[model samples]
Target: MIGPTMTPEILARITAARAARDLSDLARQAVGTTAETISPAERIKRARRMRQMVNAYLDTVVVAEALAGADWSEITEALGRREPDTVEGEYADAVAEWSDAAEAEADAAADVEELDAWYARHREDHDPDLEKPVADLLNRH
Candidate 1:
């Protein structure tokens, strides 16, 4: 995938803005939702899930931005890791797994409903212009 090409300052600003929006949304949801009606256990579970989602989203943004401008060694050093090769391999594997999952979902979609649902869930992650290319690549494998 092509990474963002903006300067670091611009990217930082965008990331910060997105994070602020996400925080605002989360706060709004917390206030508007039936949080008070739910059991304590359910509330805890929901909070944990939200935390995981937010952390994963932020980590993805940070890693992508870092990789766009920094060398692998720099990333490894920042991470205080000794095995850059292992980290790189793990990243490649994760990407491959994600792509395989998407391709499998597409291949298994048998009807319009299934395809529509898949597209709806993944619309934000995909570009309409790349559909043909992605399909072609998936078909070859």
Candidate 2:
């Protein structure tokens, strides 16, 4: 049968992001939906699940890059060449920028129903039958 095909890098990033988001959602639910919903048992379970998901995602990233023979040394060295203090300051600025952008995104994300619909549409559009078995295997937890 014909299978789904995508660039390795794109697939890796999407898989990583989805897994990260799923872990975040579970952690959020576990810690407490609000100020009052925290249950020790639920929190423990959520923490375990989040850790497992994170490890799995990291493993996926490692394997994906290994398969591609991606060498990160050059990238790392280039990034490391910046003065440590300068890097730290830039990192802090980037964090602030990201936070501001995230806050701005709150308004854009106000339409939860529309967002759900959009997600469904995109998921279907990107559906790859070829990777179904592999995806199913990894998602079995």
Candidate 3:
């Protein structure tokens, strides 16, 4: 219980599959969008950004879920691999690594929030006029 519930091999497969699916979806969307609306270069850039965002979100969710609680036996059974005990060590190591990473990400997010709050407090010095437009664009998304 100290580490992740799924073995590293299983986790890797799941992660790869998810990433592939996300990238494929992004590619499909990019292909579907009108080239006149957005240039091919911009579309590629946006697709990369979208993929990164998706992966980041997925990482957070997976880490959180692992930390909350996962049934190792069930996962192992689903994977049709070794017994739970056989992969417990690998799972624990993966969990510990992810926990540390999650903590670091949380700290970084807090720092970003702090900086954003500071910028908000001193909006005049920062591009106060563009704030509305930026907010509008973000909201539209």
Candidate 4:
């Protein structure tokens, strides 16, 4: 994640924006349909599910942008100026680090439908959520 943008206010804003987007989607989906028949509980559950999905998706985009927006020198350094080490040992250490981080993420993300909500907070989705180069890099994959 881009360090400074992660905050409680940002996360709350994201949740609000997701509600806006989901309502916008629901309005479209409800056209000439029986969506009005859904119970309030079901509607809330659906929104929660949608928020979780969007949060996970935006988290992925942020990570991708963090990579694509970086120069090679920065990327290499961020990966930890590699020293000679066993791939297995490095992999094990990385897993341990990620596991700890994942646990923290899980604590933040009580909304995720399943495991691996690596980062929380859905995005507000203003156009150009990511930079042009970053978007292009992601689109390629």
Best by TM-score: 1
Estimate the TM-score of every prediction.
0.41, 0.40, 0.34, 0.31
Write down the lDDT of every candidate, Cα atoms only: 0.49, 0.47, 0.50, 0.40
Q: Which candidate is the best by lDDT?
A: 3
Backbone Cα, N, C clashes tallied per candidate = 0, 0, 0, 0
User: Cα-based RMSD of the predictions, in order?
Assistant: 11.3, 15.5, 13.5, 15.7
- What does candidate 1's lDDT look like per residue over 47-87, in tens digits? 78678767666555545544355566766666678887776
- Name the TM-score of candidate 3: 0.34
Candidate 2, after superposition: displacement of residue 103 in Å? 37
lDDT of 3: 0.50
Model 3 per-residue lDDT tens digits across residues 49-74: 88686766455444434555666675
The list of candidate 2 runs beyond 4 A from truth reads: 1-5, 34-39, 71-141
> Candidate 1: where are CA atoms >4 Å away?
1-20, 31-35, 80-82, 93-141
TM-score of 1: 0.41
Give the better candidate number (2 or 4) by lDDT: 2
Worst 10 residues of 1 by lDDT: 105-114
Total residue pair clashes for candidate 4: 0
